[model samples]
Target: MSARITLASGVTLNTQIDGPDGAPWLILSNSLGADQSMWDEQIAFLSASYKVLRYDTRGHGQSDVPNGPYTFDDLVGDVIGLMDALSIETAHFMGLSMGGMTGLGLALRHPDRITKVVCADGRADAPAPFVGMWDQRMAAVKEGGLEAIADGTLGSWLTEDWRAANPARTKSVRDMVTATNVDGYVACCKALQKLDYLKSLGDVKIPVLFVGGSEDVGASPETMGAMAAATPGGRYVEIANAAHVANINAPEAFNDAIKGFLGV
Candidate 1:
């Protein structure tokens, strides 16, 4: 069922809850430019056997996308608040890119609330050159909104071979990106620029699984490896031929890795 959780920020974020009620919960958080829909493939694979919760972040998907600049705490609070509203005391949390950063925030800020963490195609710290890219993206989104950046954004997300091999699915994903709100897009870009969680990760005692796609353009294997190395018991895994959206690009492998991690 679809639901809404009113956060301490006074903002109401939309979410969806499905799967077996008594089963362990697996929450999927999407990348910055995408929504919870990115995990549609994973949901199809995991929902029948396990309880699955997927939601749009503050400004992405069907959720509210407010004005400028949101903090990691803001994103983390959304997940925590959603769990509270759903009566979920603790959950196995997972995210990609921006969503992964939010997962890290929860692991650090509310350690007791996460059973384990799976960060796919994400980094603990933003790479040096990415700061410039984020600035350019924020400016472009602010000026022209999501449409102006949709094509290039999609271009960077999927490998050229995947786009060539799966034009239909690629087009569908691109359409979703174009449909996002410009204000929300820009706000997330600004948030991406200010992201830094090197210290926070040091305190993440929960088991963490870092999955990086060999073809990932967003966060490289080297970077994600560094992120995993930072966590106490974090381990890194690579999905062959998968890009930024590993769950979409490599659903079977993504599903297996996550299922094994959560043991559900």
Candidate 2:
């Protein structure tokens, strides 16, 4: 069953917990436009050895969509709050894209709370050159709503062959993108435009795993691997024939990489 927890910050998040209570905890955080279901494929595999926790980020899933211009601290705070409510002291964290960025922040701010970190398809900083692009995206979403960005996002999220062969799956992903709350999307876009957590990673003293899709146009393997190398105990893996949503595009490979890393 799904649980709704009202955070200390006055934000309510929709969360789901599975697996045995005595097992080690593992939290799966989704990308910008996805909800807890984004990690559906990995649940059975992961839950076998872990108390798996999945949640919808504030603006993306069934969670509250607060008005715009949120900060990294706010997002991180939400996770901390959820952990507190669940009485979890620490857990292995795996996040994709925006969620991965949140993991980075959580590691830096609450290092004691994260045992291992997996940052998949996430970036540490946003270049100034991309500011204009982000502004344009925000403008488009505001003007045309989520429909404005669905096609472009899907194009970057999956490979051409995958889209062609998996039309139904592709449509499902498209639905996720277009269903995103416009206010949340715009707010997240604004946050991404100013995000910069690279320099702070040096203090992150936890084992880190960086997963990237070979074909991901947004966050490539080279970039994510470099991020891994920069961290003290960082490792890297690449899933071939995958794109931004590598976990979904290449579930077996993605799960293998994670299972091997976690010794599951």
Candidate 3:
């Protein structure tokens, strides 16, 4: 069932919980500009054995959009607050893009809260060139809105073959991107610009898995693999022919990788 949960910080996050209620807890966090629906595929596959929890981040889906210039701390706090509200002391977390970054922060600050973590297509830092690109996107959004970047985003998010073969899914992703709250999107962009969490990878002690898309320019497979190698107990996997959103573009492989990670 889906409902809204308000945190102590007064941020109300839209959440959906499914599967056997008594099962182990697992949290699915979505990418920037995406809501909980991004994990629909993963949820369906995992929920049978895991009590899955998926929530729209503070400003993305059915959640409230506060003012601009949010921080990773705010994002991390929201997830912890949600767990507390639901009386879950710990959970296995899986996140993509911005969501993955949040998992990193959560594992760092509240290591005990996460039993394991899967960071998919997540970058640990934003280089100057990427920051410049983000700045350009922010300016374009201010002028032409999310639509201005919709095509470009779609192009990067999925492989050409996947987009051509799955028009319905492509449309769904495009709509999700276009429907994103502008203020929230820009705030996240700014937060990403200031992110520098790569140096803290060694601090993460729990079992960690990093999944990357072979074709993802944003978070290349090599980079994700390097992150996994840096951690004390980390592993890496890459989905071939996948782009930025590997979980959607290559769900079968993604699910297999996740299941293997959990088995370890």
Q: Model 3, 1-264: lDDT tens per residue? A: 999999888889999999897899999999987889999888778998899999998779999897879899999999999999999999999999999989888888888899888999998888899899999999999888899999999999999999999999999999999999888899989888988888998898788889989999999988888888887888889999999999999999989888977652
TM-score of each: 0.94, 0.97, 0.98
Give the per-residue Cα lDDT of candidate 1 at 133.
88
Cα-based lDDT at residue 221, candidate 3? 86
User: Each candidate: RMSD to true structure?
Assistant: 1.6, 1.1, 1.1
- What lDDT does the true structure give each of the candidates? 0.81, 0.87, 0.90
Best by TM-score: 3
Please list the residue runs of candidate 2 whose C-alpha ends up more than 4 Å from where it truly belongs after superposition: none
What is the C-alpha lDDT profile of model 1 across 179-199, one tens digit per residue?
A: 787777777777787788976
Candidate 3 global lDDT: 0.90
**Top lDDT model:** 3
Number of backbone collisions per candidate: 0, 0, 0
Runs with alpha carbons beyond 4 Å of true place in candidate 3: none
**Candidate 2 Cα RMSD (Å):** 1.1
